[model samples]
Target: MDTPNRLAAAVSPYLLAHARDPVDWHEWGDEAFAAARRRDVPILLSVGYSACHWCHVMARESFSDPATAELINRSFVAVKVDREERPDLDRIYLDAVTALTGRAGWPLTAFLTPSGEPFFGGTYFPREARHGLPAFTAVLAAVSEAWRGRRSEVAAAGAALARRLASPPPTADADPGPDALGAVYRALERDFDPVHGGFGEAPKFPPAAALEFLLRITDASDAPRAAPMVQATLAAMADGGIHDQIGGGFSRYAVDRRWLVPHFEKMLYDNALLGRLYTRAAQVTGDPGVAGVARTTLDYLVDDLGLPDGGFAASEDADSEGEEGRFYVFTWAEFLAASGDAASLAAPVLGAAPEGNFEGRIVLHRARPAEAVARDAGTDSAEVEEAVVAALEGLRALRANRVRPERDDKAVAAWNGLAIRALAESATVLGEPRYLEAAVRAARFALAELRRPDGRLLRSRRAGRGDVPAFCEDYGAVALGLFALFRADGDPAWFDQAGGLVEDMIDLFGDGTDGGFFATGRDAPSLIARPLNLSDHPTPSDNALAAEALLTLAAYTGEARYGERAAAVFRVAGRLFEGAPTAVAHLAGILAVALAPARELAVVGPAGHPTTAALLAVAEESFRPDLFVAWGDGHCDGGIPLLQGRVALEGRPTAYLCRGHTCTGPTMDAAELRRLLTRRFRLSDGERRVGP
Candidate 1:
């Protein structure tokens, strides 16, 4: 019962759990390496994030044991890294581990030389070797003996590993056309689960970025293949247990092929990205189901996760009172007690039998359509839906009284920026002013609390602490959010703030010599090698997003510099697409914008100009990711390529459609504006030039 002495003093909860161990523990930094060199011992590097379940298991079983800790402390300079805090470190090390061992996961246990070159690595070694893997203690003893006695062999192996890690295989770009996009789609199709949505088998993650890429490709080319892939995936996710039926958001992912069992963690980034996708999907397909999911996700943020200052909280833990999925899973008896007659009606449709998905606890799901449930109950579908809602409301109240999962209330600037953008976009699509207001408030809070005195943004703030230096993602994402705010509201100040951040990002994070931006700023901690991860994770990489942000800023501000910067970043990483196209979807979206004709609509008139409103409505209704809309007033600059010299016609609100510097005649009617906007996509370029 005594506090573990090893990591008890550590700030990270995961590290604290191993505090009382016999092993000597060192927080990741220069001090750890210095001590290793002084003691003439090899280094043991452990990498993992806070919410990782197996990471906790490994810590409890091995790191906290006195015998194990003693061995580790004596032979190795044991270091612990919170991967979330230092993803650049994690990236290089993970790549090293994967290369050395041919596999990777967290709590990543890797053996490294004094200079920090990994020679051996694996994930989740048992306290005692079992399951066709070496026991942690035996592996430790063998490695330690080898380090002391077989120094030459260890050094040679370390040298080879270091070389391999240093030199990644080349990604050539011999062909650069739609074929590259086709290659990604082919990969997705190969791994696609036809019965359920998403790629691969069990433990399916929401591929929001990849799906968004497909959606954009389909919309641009009118490709039917991509559309169905997207629709099927979205539909499966919405209907599955991965979606919280009682709550408003999605779990981290489904643990099974059917999307019936989830890992139970709810991440802020997942909800933000998924919300935006659903909103856009609804716009594209006019599917009310997609709209419902989007609305519910936004509501969850506003009602449960929104911070007092307007920024959203980071995550909700998967474990509730030391048990995973405890807050969500329920027994049949518990459901019956809570639902009364409603349970009888819903039970048959939900497959709520005595034996359930997880040891008699049924994770609620809809096995049949609402109409089928309605038919079985001899009621209207609407009535059945209302009854189901009422039952869920009651169940939610009961569940609230039970023990809840610990909420991670840290406000991350990058994630909050994502939430802000999603909210603003959702507000516009769903016609909800409160969502817009929430977005504006969060943006204001971020600007106030997340910014340093010198105007550089901070990455995160928690427990009244607010000085973590912001990375590229924070600056780029917030800038994107600010641009979204500018579009949602006709405020030029938001645009100004966004533009300022873009300048700050370039000044601080730009690799002036090579081109693309670095994940860490010039003043941030130095790693073995500065890495640029363009692949999308739960969120897009900072570099890919930076390109997108720059392109968007260019569209809105009429700044050619922004466009040039975006193009340069894309070109710098152009070769990377040959091997890792999935990571560069954000860049791909930006490229699509570049290849297409840039369309900017300028509505010049009063704030409530009816004609302006009509044109604005038309712009909103149409799903054009590339289109930028702005209201033109005397205070607002009209020199933007699409707005300059665009005068109001006959004292009425007028819209100007401009490509490059040339503008068409001002139109006051919504029909005329739609015609102008759709003309290019509807007709061949040659035909359009001939005025057919």
Candidate 2:
């Protein structure tokens, strides 16, 4: 066994992967910076995650090479950072990298001063000069020379970057009104591919957040016109190669606009968001196809991404057997051997080319249906369909024996929170109890394992350790998860737990003088400056999620203070939301909740009553973004303020739809309650998308 480096003592799986390298790597800490200062050299900072393929390439090409390692060890202090573990550091440095290089990505290479300030950086560099870029060793030599010779210039750049990092971020010039959302939709309309369904040209992302935002604004009336975009995109993704045609789950993003061929990595957050997005869309439109996609995504999580301890795994590496897409892609000979009668019929249907598209192999995608393929091949449609199904099952079985993508076993708190919310909400909308149970199981595991006794949420759990203090997203998302659990089963304990988290979050990360919550706690080891990040990065933004947690807690507890704090948060970020509504889509969602003053729907009946389930189903199926639900057994005397004084009408199941502390009317008929919710969706009668 090789001697482990400083990173062996670290918790991040990504960092530990490099602990055996000869680069003399130090984990991101003051100790690394102190070493740089003592050695009188610049700090070589490299930040990447476990699922990143390029990070591995750099490790193999340069960090593992003794010559490169000796050069780095002699001339610079090498620091390796797991971006997932310390997003605060990632955010600050990524901003600087972008400011310096005009672009940024994983395997981020940056030159920092002894004091942890970035002066020059870029994404992946080759070991030697190639592909229009200088080699990594050449870069190290140049930076070292610059540090030694032109020390003043390097120091000036670092100081200037530090100042830029400390400056406040730009906000929206105006309040985020309906016009802001309308503008984003108009832009979406411009970029949406009429042929492929997703926005833009090649390299398409699912746009889950954007799709969900559209779902919310669908029909300031009963019929939402923006639905075609969402429907088209989902259908395109389902039929595309990016979705696992043999297994279940979609990939990270498509490499081509036609949704054929993907980056191959699978992230927990993407699936979670996609599952909830599809499930909610199904509930709104009653589309069985969309519902199926949601089911497939959730099942994939359960079957492929689950951990032994009940927590979900963070991600699956994009590579298997040290080759990217090997397990996922198939060759022509292999396909023919695997599928006999179905080979000819399925080949073209699965978009297999004669010459092959990906490194002499085909990346499978269902470009056409079995029926279509049968027509082209002059075969029976029924037989072709059956054959295709059989072939898929056989392929899946054959692939099972192949080495699988490395699973990152770390259960990240923020990502888990996203998972729990997805599962719980999908359970309600899909009427699937198993999904709800999965949500509860994850929530319990996160709370019990990732939470500190002092009420701090840890970032990730790996090999029975919960070390890193929770960031802003952890608090926001986990609290939201607990709130979802409470609503799903009407448990006061979950609500109380969520409420406690909200209070602690406020104490730790709140900005009393400013409006939005900071990205780190007050007690957090100081970076150059505390970042108040509001932009979305695949998942919802911290400020947006924070607003959601507080606003929801306010609705449940009927506390104006929590609501006021959320309002304060909005005051600061209004312009940012208004200008780039798509980037802050979740904030737009939460803001709608706040402006609607949020409706409270209380269903009171016996837990086991059949009538209760009927009403609950109605509540679940209805798309009420501005409303929160409280289910009870006619006993609302506990911690849930929204449930207080709500009772079944004449012992029959009843629903009370309240706005501020007052119920509009009590109804025993589920149909009547559904009608009331439908009315809330109408745009006429002065009904705004949110509040009037």
Candidate 3:
């Protein structure tokens, strides 16, 4: 029997995974470092998340082995960290790993001095030497030996890293303008897999933020390129195995370029961000298929991830029954058996090779586009799509009896914030009241449960305790979510809540000297140096989300201070905007929003008035990614600046369209308001496309 370690009391599932490991694993904190100092040994830090598959593989192959565990236990004080729960440690260590190794990925292994400055690290290692990499045991022996015999050199290296992290980063002169957007677009075009529909070759993530950037750049000049990429990527991902045909929502990423064979974890942030992008894309391109995809994803969130009260789970694990992709992949026989009458059409559409695509089983990806399949099956595309939807419904029911993947039920505040914003925004655009209700529930829960009375937001919740104070992303994203809810429902209290959260964020994460938000809060535990997050990885950066929230808040309140605060961030990370900007897509999008002329839309009338409701719906459904909007029914108490002097004209619903705080004459008719909004902004190339 294996002995339990200190992680047995931990809240993180990733840490608890090793609770029974033979190694004397310690949870990350001063206690672990104290032990390292007391023993005069280096610290071995392993960072990963619960949903990470490679982390599981490393645990099974190396950490679980008694011989390898003995070496780790004896030579160094082993510390386990879940990246999701403690992104600060992850950020600091990951940067050190990248600086030392030129690349970074999970199952992050770092050797730190007792004082907690990283000196050496790599990713996964096998128990014995393989793939031209040293064995875990061998690496441990060398690091331990160096710590003892070469103490002066190790201490010097640690001191050097400490200094490097402590130094402030140099600011860039360039602002992200049209020139920067074009450069990033051209780079994406160059790297885009024309055949597969993603930016890179394989291991393809959905590029959610980049797609959003494209959605925002919908001027005539950008549409020609951005439209095609957005459509192809959304279509390919929806048609591929990465999207669960039976269950809704998307897998973490496709392992292949063609969106087949995913890593299998379904993350709340991925679906939330992607749902917003798809709905926006559908509004822009008028693609019903794309809209259907967005709707399906939203429904999945409500059904699968949403907790009974309102908050959402962090992630669904990739592995099931101790095997990767086991719950999702189907045998050829099972696929045909489930299809029955439609087997002839469904078999070809589902890409079921006789020997299977992976591990002797079909991963259920689209073998060909539905249009081509329609041509071959002697039917129209619409009829084929109907048949395919029916077939998938049957398969979904069939798979219900299969062992489901494990779900990590912890509700992290930042991810729920992303979900809330997506759901609330989609509710207005997609005309779904249920989504709005869900968003309200989530926002209310976040404010009530995940926040302290002192106005500090907590990181996560499990069972009942909410202990961890929020990071930068947690504060920014939750505040943005509340802002979106306020916009959708016209509630003054939501606006008030959002404003308070933003002020708290500015107080906690804002860098007074440098003028941008840091990744961790002022109250967060001390590390070697506070990480300044400027890049978006998988999700939007803490800094960029803050910039976006602040910009929107400024527009709503007519506050120049908020806008000025966001501008300071642009000054610091502007070089990244010109160089490799697509990777930092959230920042790039916000910069465009700040630079472009913003339109504040105010509709004034009673909610019970028919004409006002119609005008509001039209404005709500329009593709106005750049618009700051408010709905007022003869009231200035809505708390939006656009509603301050707005009034209904002659007891008729009136629409006020303004730019740079200047409004046009009030219009009563919805059609006239539409025309005014339509005529307000013309494309740079003098070509007009439909929708806002």
Best by lDDT: 3
lDDT of 3: 0.84
Report, for every candidate in turn, its global Cα lDDT versus the true structure: 0.77, 0.83, 0.84
Least accurate 10 contiguous residues by lDDT in model 1: 683-692
TM-score-better candidate, 1 vs 2: 2
Q: Rank the candidates by lDDT, best first.
A: 3, 2, 1
> Which lDDT tens digits does candidate 3 get at residues 265-338?
99999999988888888888888888888999988888899987689998988998898988888887887777
Candidate 1 is scored at a TM of 0.91
- TM for every model, in the order presented, reads 0.91, 0.96, 0.96
Query: lDDT by residue for model 1 over 536-596, one digit each (tens)?
Result: 6658888777988888777765778888787667667667566766667666656655656
Q: Provide the lDDT at 129 for model 3.
A: 93
Where model 2 places Cα greater than 4 Å from the true spot, the runs are: 170-174, 221-225, 378-381, 681-692
For model 3, which pairs clash?
Answer: none
RMSD (Cα, Å) for all candidates, in order, is: 3.5, 2.2, 2.6
The C-alpha local distance difference test score for the whole of candidate 2 amounts to 0.83
List candidate 1 segments past 4 Å from native: 1-24, 167-175, 220-222, 376-379, 638-651, 681-692
